[model samples]
Target: MSSSAVGHVISLGCRLNLAESETIRTLIASNDVVVINSCAVTNEAVRQTRKAIRRARRERPAAQLVVTGCAAQMDPAGFTAMPEVDRVVGNAEKLLPASWTSHAPALVQDIMAVRQTAPHLAASFSAHARAFVEVQNGCDHRCTFCAIPFGRGNSRSVPAGAVVDRIAALVDAGHREIVLTGVDLTSYGPDLPGAPTLGLLIERILTRTKVERLRLSSLDGIEIDDRLFALLTQEQRMLPHVHLSLQAGDDLILKRMKRRHSRGQSVALVERLKRARPEIAIGADIIAGFPTEAEAHAANTRALIDDCDIVHAHIFPYSPRAGTPAARMPQLPPATITARAAALRASAARRRAAWLDAQRGTVQRVLVERPGDRGHAGNFAEVRLPPHEVGTIATVKIERAQDGKLIGMPA
Candidate 1:
């Protein structure tokens, strides 16, 4: 329950949403208000958003409740119907200062009609050690199970100059790491003049800015361009951890989900990445028990975790959204979906444990985010060490792995 002169902002969903909430915090000016930056990635996400809104109302009874983000953008009337909500702002409208006025009611516009991304500049992030710069926004692809495209409009990118300048500013502010985030990160720059690639953007940032560590958010494996692949192999500042948007591992399921890459293609891409950089760590977002998923299909996805040497996996049990194509497909039983999700998680836990064990005795560069013993290593693995200066990157000699984190001392 952090407070400002205006209000408290509660963020949900991806890092992109969290970045937006930071901007929202700077816009409004009423202490008696509470704004919920929501998520609509899954049905469960919507439920959680609603739960947060209600809880906020109970805690701050007099605070005016404002609902915004993908969930609100997708279904404005639904949130406006809530008795606790006083206003509903869309994804596009939430950034505007006018929408924060007490007079504003529901400011949702046609998201599909939006073509250009208006840059939201922030000098710093809420976290001290790292900051996120939004290089792109919206998604062009229409995955059958995703509602994000409708929540966010067609693909638009922030100009390269603006991005480089922002990175330089964050670096000057003493941030040790900078993360480039977007709705569809790899699709960056196609809409801009000359249609420069994301690789070109990265090159410009590295050359023009004094950024120490640069990381990218989730990316589609099929979109890894040749130039980007080269940079990954050659660049030391580019972090060696990649979290892929590989929703399912079976070819048939992937086709049904309208994913661009095939099972073989995904595996091949991971192989190439590992070959280029042996120290690289792989992670993925996998949906368990997707529509029409069988035991064999689930098994293929589970097998892919080991095949790709994926150490971190985000396992989602399929939840039908209101308007997605998958929601209209033949649905699996609740029990079946739950059981398969559990199995996938259990398999992922074993793989993660093995990967952690392998890190023992290895020296790692950890960027400390907390005062005591918490931070993330270069591979994005959570690590615990002796007290170190916050916002400083320290070298640690890994000695043990426990409770999903690596334990180490200063090297």
Candidate 2:
């Protein structure tokens, strides 16, 4: 091992999760040890995390194999069962030191002794030219279909000054783009002494930091509020793309799911945002088959998305998560969920195609991430002139739309 290695998940289920892992990486990088970042989102994810711990143990034979992330947060006990693991901790604030124990026992204690320690707060870009920063850590809203609230606690905001310093550090590291991510990004700054709002936080970054082209991860309808939207409209650095949670369009289903926001509110957010920025690409997430969602609800969702002019949609079929209130909610046969998911997927495909088509001939400043399927683009889209040498930025003119991606030529 390079030093004292600690492991974390590499690939994650969402962009927010990816950002969180990068935060964890920066924390341990300064300690001068081999930090094993994981890339296992599938069943292989568990295998890889476990394997890395074993390898690290073999190399050091005494280094601490501290595990964290969705997999570890979701299944700490399972991961601790691995003989290589010296310490077992949940998603709590305390950094459980393996020195306290030879092997982790049944982690039954709350460990309330650990105050919320922000891990370094120094953000690092997982890629070449851009970094992902987190301004919030946990979630307060509970959608029936998600287990994030269990892994991550109630909404907790990162201090605004810390965020500003982190942004400056990222900029100093030569990153041109920064995507602010969190469990609830809108909830940022409430826990701080001054309690400056997310608006002020962004204002600080824009006015103070030199980082270019700031983007945001997933957002909720109610969180946008009025002031944030106004800032979004005015800010050139803030990306035009937004992925808001629009789980379903039916009001009754939304109530049952405990989404706490009405479809009208989501629609209004879209309308105001589009009015403010006409070319803005709006994206949404839809649960094709919620526990008690009706056929009409699905239809309503499709209609709502179409009306909102959403450029893209991510369709989920309501996976049953363990230890969540939704797991015990109700029933829908697997085949039906699958069929509805397929239908929604078809709609999303068309939605993306139409959006890209509208952008044809318009120039977009594209940040070319890693390579992808065929000769297609990576992370963000439309990289013209060959499969891109990652870390370079190029202006691309939307030439055509194909297979949910924007195919483009050099502008």
Candidate 3:
């Protein structure tokens, strides 16, 4: 790894996988090799995967093209069959190259025992000097509409000590803000022997490290408990943002989707979060036009979302994958799916506008990730800046909202 060779990583999935790739970037032993983490998380994922391979191969024709992550894990034949890919490893095997340490013994050194990787994201694109740190990988849930179970199996958590060490490194790397990403971050550390919950893991992070701003990627509706919510409420540094995967707002659709939380339960949970973290940017993932979904069911969804105080929404139409149970179920008509998705997208835009309207004339601490004309927005939120450093954090008074960004002037 010390030798000059360009090493690039390709990731194709959710934030958990992306965070894992980030960890790989932090610790790879070669400064000479450029690391590129690619992503593919949809129907276009296969196309993108091929495209990434072609691009990587063209640039580094002699370099080893290691295919890994969900696409590689689930469909090794398809990934390795590509002439560009030299080696095929499952999601777990991809992180191996990053385990190379100077202190590693010559003979007995093996990262197989090192277990889960808790690499803090270093080269974050966040406008603020922030980074993402993966606290865990893999999933235990078997949501009927998902292929993740086929992609990443089981629930194995990173060790508490190792997680703390990675956070220390991230802080040393000048990352003032850190986001913890995982498939089911709420289910963090359950696989460990001592049964350290995410709350316990977070307690360690906040108490042990100097990480300024800490945020979570997404939370499963069923996993939020008093302890974790309490920690977020208590910590000022914990960013006021929670992305809840509200796959469906209708109870019938939710039941079919196999989301553990009932519609009422989800609504109640959102209300609870609103009460505890009022200023929190509560977001949801809505799967519009699910199989067997009626027009009335979708109506209920829009109504529920409207009433939920959800500020941000990412709506995905049911895209049936071959392996998922939903794929075998009565499929939603593609045209219907498209219609519902468009409606939901418009609704989300309205929600964004409403949320931005609420923020006008208020002061928000924005994390300036890039240099504009001058300064930048906080929280990596964009704004015309006084052109400061990429990692600069600035407090700005919001004048208005424009083009999905909170426009502000220096506070």
Candidate with maximal TM-score? 1
Structural similarity to truth (TM-score) of each candidate: 0.97, 0.81, 0.86
Model 1 spans > 4 angstroms off: 2-6
Model 2, 1-411: lDDT tens per residue?
343444433344566556655555555444423333332223445566677777777776655556555556667677667787655545452233432233444343332233243534434565545677767767767777776665666677667777788889878877778878787777776667787777788888898898778877778878776667877787888877777888888898888888878989888888888898886777787887777767888788777767777766777777677666767877688788888889877777776676667767777777766662122122244444456656566667777766556666677
Worst 10 residues of 2 by lDDT: 372-381
Tens-place lDDT digits, model 3, residues 302-358? 876677767678788778766788888987789999999898888778887888877
State candidate 3's TM-score.
0.86
Supply the TM-score for candidate 1: 0.97
Tell me how far the alpha carbon of residue 190 in candidate 3 is from the true structure, in angstroms, after superposition: 2.4
Q: What is candidate 1's lDDT per residue for 310-404, written digit by digit as tens? A: 89899999999878899999999989999999998998999999999999999999999866478999899999998888898989999999999
**TM-score computed on alpha carbons, candidate 2:** 0.81
lDDT of 1 at 91: 93
lDDT of 3 at 404: 78
Look at candidate 1 and give me any clashing residue pairs: 6-30
